[model samples]
Target: MQFLEDPVLWIAEWLREVLLGWGASELVTNMTLNFLGAFVVGAMIMVIFILLTWIERKAAARFQDRIGPNRVGPFGLIQPIADAVKMLTKEDTRPKGADVVGYVLAPIVSVFSVLMTWAVVPFTQKWIGADLSVGVMYVAAAGSFGIVAVLLAGWSSNNKYSLIGAFRGVAQLISYEVPLFLSLLVPVFLARSMGVNDIITSQTAVLFAIPWLNIPIRGFFVLAAPLSVVIYFISSLAEVGRAPFDLIEAESELVAGYHVEYSGMKFGLFQAAEFLHSFTFAALMALMFFGGWQGPWVGTNNLTGWLLGGFYFMLKTFFFYMMVMWSRLTFPRIRIDQMMNLNWKFMVPVSLVLLMGMPLIDYGLRGQELWLKYLVLFLFNLIVGLIAFAWAARADRRVKTHTRVRFEGRPVAVMPQAPAAAEDETAG
Candidate 1:
């Protein structure tokens, strides 16, 4: 498995060798290498954060059948550059009576929390900044920090709308974390390790190739625990404040949500964090469920392999980002209550059951053939789905009027008039 050697490690080793061979001190050489790695990772994540602004706009344009940013540059690739300039030059205005400290800290907290998760993510075998044994737990913890930022922004803004939005955000974030963490436990349980690198290594073998039938298989932990993947993905969308679950930022009600009092890059930074988190969420899903950095013969050398590894990671990441874009364009936003009910009433229970059941099934079927093992796991998923459907049907009868709550105080509402002939008949 020398082919699996981390490119980053090899490069650092080569640097160390050259430095030592030149009579340089070991401490200095090691320090230099660590600094270089940190610079590269930080720079890469920030650059992507800027580019994703354009990427999401372009993706949304395509979905809506509109010309996205063709005017700025070819396919509007430089559109984000223009927007960045605008945001930087704009006035940083603070609303009167706003808390200076928390208002400023909110954007920094929001952006940093999401960016820091990249430290433990393995782009290649050796590319990670840290390989902490509790990497998954670290990620889950980091992901929740955005909620703190939201609360700060809302409370500090001294705006009623901001506070309302912040409370809504708190509810959504608190509700989703349950399912998100529960789903995350599946991979941890199966890999028998919490380290992201170890989890990646455990998935090195074929996912599902049948010897008798000659059917090829493609899987990582995602295939073994498909329910977890489903729940995690849905929860992640909510976590990032995407549509259908974005009631936290319900513009129709909250008027720009928690950061309503901020202007200039401060406002821009909060917006960037939201979109950036969405992309990061997709990347994490790819790494967790899609055999991250595993691709066919990407590079022959350690250096080239590292390049290839980063490529595969980005490709897989953008694929999920596209899925997120599609989901946003397709679904209408649900009311706050519906959003809560969907998460707490449905997703939380289903995800809990899946998490509890997977280990039992795997242990009980340890001696059985691989196919039989999978069959039992799949049956378990099917039963959970049916249970969800039945519960939903029963819920429908109980909360049939739930959806109309959002329209309770409609103002400036106008009813459309029929065609001339229809209108004339109605008058007659």
Candidate 2:
């Protein structure tokens, strides 16, 4: 009956007992368990990656008003499996002058980099894969591997288009990473810890309070640092190469981008890496901004609480994942110049402002009441937000005027009108 409390640990304990009885060393048993846990988490992510394909397709279909993949299986449930088979059976090709080593290793590195990020994601208080003191830095380092993968794919492909796409990807990713890292600092500063679990624990109090009415909401970071959340999400979308930040993969421009020369399972791996990476960042967003697994009926002190916490974590992550999909399906892809301008001219500056402003606010408001602290912070954010919006509006107006003038100045050919419309009416 105790197994019902925390089935995962209970099963592990049972396995330990069995292994010990069989004379296995304690170190070996522990190693076995850790390996199994890592394997399980990795397998789960891969399975979810398959499901994401169907989910995104169906969501896009709904947005476009069409029935998607109904012919494959019940509600198209087996479509991903079918697609997997196609990828497996498809012909694999390599360009004649391609660098075989990097070409083959590129997709593997891309997928591995995405997989490593999950190692630090805290699913629940007890269910985390790792609780490193520098978990936040670990995630950042792991993500940088993706840049290497993109470069390899582009340079190794021996195609000029692939090289160009890779260069653009590198530029976009590196540019957006500035704001992403800066936005991440807000949560770390607020929580005063780098561990994901600590960050989640710090959010246990109410985020906002109306003291007079005695109304309060749970202390999710989103409510406290919405500008940080916005910056984080937008920057993450660019990092994932999702639209309108998808200029790296702009088919009209680069003809399939960095992976253009990849075929068969190699291409499939790149696609899988992308889907998983998007979901990973969404999970990170949920963990950082939405309180990870903290919600009603979720208790971390008890073993049974882990199960409930897992449910809440997945729910929050799915919500954010759907938001990512929505953005991809709804927005048109922007030009490379436009994308760069948005990052350098807007996102980077705003994130730097937020990163600088948060620490000052926290320092000044130290030891203050929660309500007063959040209130002051909120007011400060509002002021900065209003100013930023005004600047953006003015810039947009200027660009529009310039564009209109440039287009209006182009020569136009006038069509000749009928010579005698009035006389033709009587003649007819």
Candidate 3:
């Protein structure tokens, strides 16, 4: 109880008088606390990323009906640590013709960009690191640096395969960013704020229930626009380069892709960044759509609120991570053309329409009954979801019967080429 009552107050006091030799200003003291808090948060996130990697491997193993990483301490709990050690001790080799500077800088850039995005993510009311007014924009902007690093890694390797892989990555991420932003805008519009903290606080405000139905229709963009959430999840999957969207590292075609020439800890950095990006996106998705830091069945008491909020945030993020891993293990890698088609044709248009339509619907329901609002929203989403599901089912059926064949630098249907036109024509 005492420990919970004052976590860092004692340390703060000691640092103020002993280290600074004077009482610190409010800004300085707060800054110090923020840094300390960020450090702890950052460390926890890193550990979560490591654990998520193991979870992914185990999940993938289960999907494939194989045992994965079971030898390293209790169901492979220590597998990540062992992998880290092996990476640390292994030889760091550079390709003969590779550009040393860019080759060395790429992984650092990738990891750093991912870490920078975390700076603006608010864990709780008092636990934000920076609390930038443009928090979402900052996250979006910082995310692009990773794409740059990937491109550089591929280009500087002086390898054709790496260059192609990097180009694929650039194309995938840039195209998906459109839908990603569109879906993200739904929450920002509903909250009417650019700050992450403000968005979270907005979600906690309660709206009065309608007299008859008694459904409280307030806060939570997810309840308001479920389609946006679905779009955002799909766009995020592409953005993070996960399965069905992992053409950038397609083993069969690209031969390990952008980091083909990398080895040792350098390559380890890329792998870490991949896991980190996946984890970070999951966290962002939770924050945006799931009322981040909102506890499950908890009152608004200070300590309970903070702890529960963080717990819920982590729980949702980890669950999403599991979903990503499940998809990776269960689905085959989509062809590059199919990837592009899905993004440009379906995701972008649907996201844009939802982004525009949701706000209008929300506005029109300003003075309506809460039940009416929810009913309308639910019906709209249900109709759209049914349409999408039907389309997907039809596409799947087509894919099952379609024989994939490539000819003359393009994919096509050969239809068995009509049995080579029978040489008996000459005998006639």
Q: lDDT for each of the candidates?
A: 0.84, 0.90, 0.80
- Candidate ranking under lDDT, highest first, comes to 2, 1, 3
Worst 10 residues of 3 by lDDT: 1-10
Residues 115-202, candidate 1, lDDT per residue (tens digit)? 8888898887657899999999999889778889999999999999999999989888988988988888888887889998888777
Q: Candidate 2 lDDT, tens digit per residue, 91-210?
A: 999998999999999999999999999999988878889998888899999999999999999999999999999999999999998999898988898899999889998888875657
Clashes of 1: 0
| Predicted structure with the largest lDDT when compared to the true one | 2
Better of 1 and 3 by lDDT: 1
Clashes per candidate, residues 3 or more apart or on different chains: 0, 1, 1
Query: Which residues of candidate 3, in runs, are more than 4 Å off?
Result: 1-14, 22-38, 207-219, 297-301, 369-371, 385-428
